[model samples]
Target: MAWPNPFRRRTAKTVSHYGYTFEWTDEHLSEEDAHKLRFTYDELADRVLARLDAISPPQKQPPSATATSTTEKASSVESEQSKPASRDLYALLRDNKDSDPVLRELWDQVTTVPEWVDWPQIGRGQDVFYRYGGPNLTGLAYQALLGGMGGARVVETLARTGGFSIKVARRRLFETTQHVLQVTRSLDALEPGKGEGFESTVRVRLLHAAVRKRILGLAQARPSYYSVAEHGVPINDLDSAATIATFSSTLIWLSLPRQGIFMRSAEAADYIAMWRYVAYLIGAPTDFFSTPSRAKAFMQSVFLYEIRPTQTSVLLANNIITALHHQPPGYASAEFLSASARWLNGPQLSDALQLPRVSLYYSLLMLGQCAFFAFVSYTYRAVDAWDRKKIEVLRKVFWQVVVESRYGLEGKTTDFDFNGPGLILWGLFQHVVRPQLHWSEISRCRSCFKLLPARESTRMYGVHALII
Candidate 1:
């Protein structure tokens, strides 16, 4: 007994560590507890079995087969994501075979416009007054009357009326109607129908018919598809005909300077309509104030008045207040505003010298870089104190310029602000706030820096970089 220690004895009564020893007892686990224990045992056993299996053997498989499977899955995902969400004309036609002939005719009439018509060749740029001059005056005047009753009304109306849902429709109607009036005024402008004379050609007739039908269809679809505010108030609740008429008149007035090239009133109107329609479809504003210059001003104001100057401006204001019992150091709101104002209004020698049209685009690119820097500086200061969502919204508005500048629809060279907005947007992207999310394609295009020959790259880089 003294020779053998009980702890070290190898005997049948000694329990083996690796093996289970079952003993019957009166105590019993509840169903849940028993199930949990069983599950734990199963998991442990499965892990053990897996380890044993991994060390036990290796399965032979074809590398090509595995690669093909992975490739197929990736291809499937890419295809699904790449497909456009909207229905095409042909598909819509095929789907609506059983509909009324009138509706079908309307659809056919609208779809007749070629998807890729050479808009410039069709005299798309005829209305110089409505396109540029009128808007410029209005925008300049509007900007001057800062924080007035008129300004308040304008802001309120715009805020209430313009939203994601009805924006496209409103834009379409505004653009098309304006162009129609412009072309109507310029009798010598190109006609969509057959060639040149008073007699309507098939192309012109077809185009006109298509435009009319599309307009009608848009009108009909408005009630159903249009977005309403929380109070069920439609964005375009204002008198449609009056609003559109005024808008059209304003556009025609702006494009008056280009009247000579349009030659005919009809051509000018058509061209203006097409141009505005295209702009609207691409999520652009119809007026100059909505342009980058104005947008920048608005953003600056928001940052100064609503964001930095207020107690609620910073991300960590509340946190700081709570931690320090409301006796935390006060941020210099005025200093921040002054700094931002200086950045915005700062004189740059480059802007004074007018470069060639192509060179001008590059200048915009530089401005965009400046904007990006401003955004980074501002955001960095507030990041610790602001709500993530609020920060993101501000960032998005700023970055929109960058994205729009790069991917926006093409516009004419004479439309400086239209194209320049993209440059301003680049500035906004760079300065206002950094976007929390980014598209690689957009980023790549924005990142592209080169001053190519004006003639060669104007359309290429200009089209790709700034809004046309």
Candidate 2:
């Protein structure tokens, strides 16, 4: 007899995100206005978009904050910023700060640190990631991206770029991990003009611009291909803002707590601050993610605003799991991934994405997995002697254990190469060397107490970060 196709549609047309969707409005703006901005894309990156002769710059129609006329995009042809394309963005900013009008203006904007930024808190925030590194990563892959497939509009843009395509899933995952790592690599990694975080974030900004232009070009070529009126700009401001929330607020409110891990109020705030700076650098609307409460509300408001999954959502979600099966830091099976995705995202959303049902064995294994992380987290949190300095030590340990191991994976990298301009190579490890860590560890960590299975020289799934 023939088997069933998990990719087949599971009737998600009427489904909605089960989470509470709050109405978002700050003192300065209303929900109605934010909706208008939702259809908007970044305008500052228009100059870089002009250089690509292969595509036309997207016109944001008329009478909107995001609206950019073709004449304005074409006007860049005469601007000095459109000179040689080979010059790296960082070096261009350094060497031609005086010459490039675009970089100069952006430089002044991003470099001037906001008075509210608290460096010590940011440092502790970095620790929060590594503090529960394993479960947090599981949260990222299973909850943030895979479960995030519910956002139909975001998936619309992702589908257009073939980003979550079966072949590109691991690359996309690792690249995102690297961006998180770089920005949180160290307290000083965000030092405006001279840090890895600063440089990489800016590169991502340019990449976002490029993608927006590419899609806008496609929509322009074939009107039926994409609807700006219906879908908004390629990567509109709301989309970008929501993207940042997935990495931060989603982790704090949804991903971590669901896995039996929870951050204290302070840790949550600092973590939000780290991503808030990232929002600023990436040109996402920042005030929305300014504090823990604000970020949570924005995330909830976004779920209310979007989260209607479609057939494409099912395809992309399953495709990511299939592509990354038996691969990477977590050499997880499709069943293992589905189980975790289901747990982290709950049954309602998982059902909408058409995630296959796993046996109770996998569920118990997940329970064991959460128990292990809770042990580690509880130990760390209970250690009264473990001060901010200990957190710093933990950060270094994470750098050595996880980050260092990732570097030489098939001679890939323990560090990012900024010698180039684009963010294409951010997730190069998938291509450079795809190491099969320890998918067995998911089971092992679950059964570590009783069975004590012999760990194959590699590490386990999400339990890669050993507190030692």
lDDT: which candidate is best?
2
Cα lDDT of model 1 by residue, 100-194, tens digit: 45334433433355454455533434333223221222211111111111111122222322211122222222222223322323335333322
Give the per-residue lDDT digits (tens) of candidate 2, residues 317-343: 898778877764446667777887888
Off by over 4 Å in 2: 1-16, 19-31, 48-87, 384-468
How does each model score on TM-score?
0.25, 0.76
Candidate 1, number of clashes: 55
RMSD of 1: 30.7
Q: What are the per-model C-alpha RMSD values against the true structure?
A: 30.7, 10.6
What is the TM-score of candidate 2? 0.76
Weakest 10 consecutive residues, lDDT, candidate 2? 425-434
